[model samples]
Target: MVYIAEENRYSDMPYRRCGNSGLKLPAISLGLWQNFGANKPLQDSRDMLLRAFDLGITHFDLANNYGPPAGSAEETFGSVYRSDLSPYRDELLISTKAGYYMFPGPYGEWGSRKYLLSSLDRSLNRMGLDYVDIFYHHRPDPDTPLEETMGALDQAVRSGKALYAGLSNYGPEDTLRAYDILKSLGTPMVIHQPSYSMINRWIENGLHDVLREQGVGSIAFCPLGRGQLTGKYIDKIEAESKSGNSSMKPEAIEPARIAAFRKLEDIAKRRGQSLAQLALAWTLREGGVTSALIGASRVSQIEENVKCLEQGPLSEEELREIDSVSAVIKDIPW
Candidate 1:
């Protein structure tokens, strides 16, 4: 069946500026970090992407090493793009990242001019696009010179291969350095992607303050704490849960995580909203966050998550109770 995008897709979700850049992204963006890989059925992944668009999610995040086989997710997205989404390209904010291990050898992964430039070319080929709206360095590369990395990203924008450049998983000091480097090169940093949820508060140490001061937009990933913040794993793991099976590694389901889930579940009960909704809304409550980058294994999950937008921000009392409970369990060793 040919997929037709929803006519009123742009009406429901509000868009926000990406830092001081001209681009505006939807409040909620879809991430293809999991389930969109080759291990999953193609039709199921396609449905999720289509459903996200119907709900007004304009941004789709991807990385070079996202697939189980490394690069298969972009291949799958390429197929989807050729078949269904080609006509709506103007309505989408497609992004891809490099810096993880995609190929083997010295320049396979990192922030070198050689690695970044070659990776962007391969990514554009895999996605069958002339250019991506945003290109990101998947992580900070301590081994590579920051100048070389910033130079490569600046070149990507200048050469018309990427419209904007961003950094992920970079701390305050490194981000400031990169921002200055890019700014000096006449291509200022636009966005930063970081892992943030009620359980993972590493960014709170100083990154959020830095982003606000520097005028960089932040998009938080894993806002549900890899499904733990959703309260789905409170009493016992469901037999059919994606991350709950016995085959799943123990490290993925730590004892402290279960304890945190129990505490979050209690807070949700008092608030009259699901733990998932609370987690999503709480991230947005912080001022610097431009959007929440979320992954949904099914169309139903996407439907449930979009409901958080309607529920809006938590009250001051609710925020206080959440913070108190969250602080006790925040140090859960992940």
Candidate 2:
């Protein structure tokens, strides 16, 4: 059967502005970082993508190194886009990044102009896209000069390879520098992608403050702490979970952490939500975050996550208990 999106898709999901840019992403965005890759089941990938759209998730995030074989996820997305999502091109916020290791040799990785631009071309080719809505430098390359990398991103927007430019995994100072460079070039930086969850509060220290001050929107990945904050690990890991698949090592969820997870689960139940819902709702409570990026191998997971928005934001007392539980959990060392 051909895929026709839900007519009321736009009604249920809330959209927020990405920084000061005109682009607005859904409050819940889908990410293809794990099981949606080529090595994974293609049918599952297609189902999840279609389901995400039905639930009003317009933003789909990707990276050059996302798939197990590297670049496979884009290829999968390309196939699905050609077959189903072509009609809704203008309505989607498709984004891909070019940092991290992609191919072999010197030019395959980093923030250099050569690597960033060329990787983007490959990403576009693989996705069968004329232009991506957003192109991001996957990570900060310490060896490369900030000017060179930011220049490449600006050039991408100017040349129309990407409608907007973004930065990922960049610290507050580096983000400010990149933003200034993009602003000088007449293409201001729009968004930042960082790893954030109740279990990992790295952004609370300074990243959030910087993003708000600089007016850059934030999309937080690992919103469930790589499945730690979800019900998947509340008891024992399912045989098919990410932890079972090596994306998250078994040792990452220790016995004590599981205990903490159950305690949090009770709080989520009290709030009329699942553990995953509680985690996502808490992540969005941060003022700087524009969206919380969620990755799933199954359509059911996406459906369950989408239902979180219906329950509304966490209450003040609930927020305090969540913080206490998160604090009691040990730092994930795996």
TM-score of each: 0.92, 0.93
Q: Candidate 2 lDDT (Cα, whole model)?
A: 0.88
Query: What 10-residue stretch in candidate 2 is worst by lDDT?
Result: 235-244
Question: What 10-residue stretch in candidate 1 is worst by lDDT?
Answer: 235-244
lDDT of every predicted structure (CA atoms): 0.85, 0.88
Task: Identify the runs in model 2 with alpha carbons over 4 angstroms from their true place.
Answer: 237-256, 286-288
lDDT by residue (tens digit), candidate 1, 1-334 = 8888989988889898877788898889999998889999999989998889999998999998888678989988998989999999989899999998889899899889999999999999999999999999999998899999999999999999999999999998999999999999999899999999887888988888888888889899999877767655554443323344555446445565455566677776676677887788888885738999999889999988887888747788878877777776543232
Query: Which candidate achieves the best lDDT against the true structure?
Result: 2
Cα-based lDDT at residue 279, candidate 1: 88
Give lDDT tens digits, candidate 2, residues 22-91: 8898999999998877788888899999989989999999999888778999999999999999999999
